[model samples]
Target: MTAARANTGIRRAPVQRRSRERVQRILDAASELIVEDGLTALSTRTIAERARVPVASLYQYFADKDEILLALVKRDTAEMDAAVDAAVGALSTVSVRTMVAATMRAFLTIYHQRPAFVVIWWRGRSNQVVYDFCRAHNKRIAADLFAFAQAMGMAQDGTVQGVVELAVEVGDRVFQLAFEHDLRGDELVIAEGIELVIGYLERHATPAGIAGVSVQGQDGPA
Candidate 1:
């Protein structure tokens, strides 16, 4: 190939990186705005202003408002997924109680770490795109937990629905407590929530189980 031809075929690395960063900036601004004022207040114009990019440029990256919101949901969920995956990996072997506590802690940490994102995610806005993505993403996360429960032989019915339900219970309550009540001051609330979940799981979990299954430390003894 001629030098010009070779150059044309090669990707311009910086351009791609810059494009991604710009898109991220827009998404970040949208998330922050929606969290502060709710989805009804989110608009491309507002996002552009907050991101300091032209409104037209926001469209260049996202086709419309729905796309932007969907992107924000996916971004927040991906971060939570990564953290949960890391915590799960660390448990190489664990008891039902420990697994339950760890799962609850990982999830609570995700929201606690980004309370705004959690608020936006659960805001139940009227955007169908955001609604659908959140539904699917939640199923995927639950599926992962289900698979883990099965692999560890903790699911009595060979189905993870029970563990998944318990985890969601812990998550929903904690989310409410954190955002709706100002329970952030009451660290015991987080611990107690974990205990409630661990109690349910332990009643059903078999002891011929993985390592670290037994509860320990401040969060356990369930």
Candidate 2:
């Protein structure tokens, strides 16, 4: 990695760090362009211009704009997954309510933290690759939640997997709604979403007879 282009503030790169830094610049440039002018503003030319990389160079890494959007989606979701996993993994006393709220909070935090993701995910979700990745993200979260449920002996029924999957589907839409009208996300909608997911889970709660199943959490309360 050499230095950023003086005025444009874009770093220019291919050694190992060089490749990594160039990728970051591309991602960052795409992010800025998207946020500044919506998806319509995104093009390899624009991204390279903003990133200070040549159009030819941008092609070497990403074949098209959709690929760049997908990259941003993947990059942001990885962080979101980490936050949700840590929240669920750290739940010392997991219940449907606590677990749901903690999960919602952690998941929502990502929207606030990554403006680029919030924009790309909502805007680019219709793209085939991004849509597929989004589905995978939902399943991954559901799987993580189900793993915790399994440790709690709530995994007795095959229905548990289905129920958790449903919760994820519902949560994804509700959260999207929360961000729909406002980029910052409407607080009222977020709270309602938390309550809605918890209530939905509570209705399908595994019988208390299975409550004694011991499970140790990662580090903190969810």
Candidate 3:
């Protein structure tokens, strides 16, 4: 996928510093608009105007509004996974509860930081395209977790990946429920979600030495 995502069809990679700055500006403006007006209100022209860039400039990097939104979603998810990778990797050893708690805290932190993403992801689920992108993101998170689990000495049995994927799907739903009525997320639901994930993984994950995705250059854990 391109930095903006394959689904986004970003026109260029923004190799230059100026281009990168402009791209960030566009994303920031889109975020503000989304937070204020919701996804249904997005358009290249409006984003450009809000960003104070030409519409042509916005299209230079993003194909359309969905692309812009997907890029924003991508940034937030990357940070979320990176946070999890750092949190667990810093530990000398990881218990199931510790790992699950780290993952939940990492994601919740990102969700709170990116209110626009919270709006788009939770409130915009009725939009099929947005939902598809998010589902893909969930699968990616599952894949990353699978790698991390293997590194952590969880058995390499065939069931591990499948189990991890299922766990991620369930966790994603629980997170959605937590954020459904409250953008900051319901504290009770958040706490229960942690317990639920830890409980499921307790039977599945075995403790071992800590490792991080950043160290493995791309195939590492989350």
Candidate 4:
């Protein structure tokens, strides 16, 4: 009877810990593989081997390679969305120049956050699922940029239609460049791009004064 007193509260078995570890291992291996070989290089068997797990176990956690890729893309997209949201929040009570700078910082932040994925995105041969998602994401950003420019009174191309189209193009290119190339920490490069865009917007908005965001190269007389 005294020996029967030994007891303990409920506790998760070690199997649960091992299962979680396996899942994490799979994700880590997949991420490394992706960085080394790009998005097109992923496969369930390959990931299983890299993760040192049974191939069947990989399927236990993920339905397929596409599912894993989808998860990664979703994480990256969420990060970009959050970055832009924060940038816009900072501009809620700031000047246009400040907002522009914040926007540039946000773009660069997202660009450099996942260099490998960005490289894959720039390679231009990703799966259609990823490509379609990217197109939709860019469309949203372009619309936001257009609205922001108009709200700031800095986007006028003699008509709303013209400015809207130009804004969309400019917004797309700005982000595309930020992620497609090595421009991180290069303030001059980033500033020059921002200045070029601002100059275009200013020229269209007001024909009288020099309304561009002044930069080192473009400040000199024409």
TM-score of each: 0.75, 0.84, 0.84, 0.63
Q: How many residue pairs clash (N, CA or C atoms closer than 3 angstroms) in each of the candidate models, in the order given? A: 5, 0, 0, 0
Between candidates 1 and 4, which one is better according to TM-score? Answer: 1
Mind giving the per-residue lDDT tens digits that candidate 2 earns over 1-222? 111222112223235888888888999999888877888767889999999999998877776787777778877888887887787666656677777887889978888877777777765566666677788778877877877666565544555677889999998888888887677898898899889887787766676413423346343322
lDDT, candidate 4, residue 161? 43
From the highest TM-score down, the ranking of the candidates is 2, 3, 1, 4
Candidate 3 lDDT, 102-195, residue by residue in tens? 7878888888889888898877787566677778878888887777667556543554577777888888888788888777899898898888
lDDT of 1 by residue, 1-222 (tens): 233322222122226777778887887788788667876777889999999999877767665666666666666677777777667666645676656666667766777666556655555546555655666666666666666666556666654564676566555565556555441424676678777766766665656443344222212111
> Which numbered prediction scores highest in lDDT against the true structure?
3
Q: Which stretches of candidate 2 lie over 4 Å from their true place?
A: 1-15, 155-158, 207-222
- For model 3, the stretches where C-alpha displacement exceeds 4 angstroms are 1-9, 127-129, 155-158, 206-222
> Compared to the true structure, candidate 4 yields what TM-score?
0.63
Clash pairs, candidate 3, are none
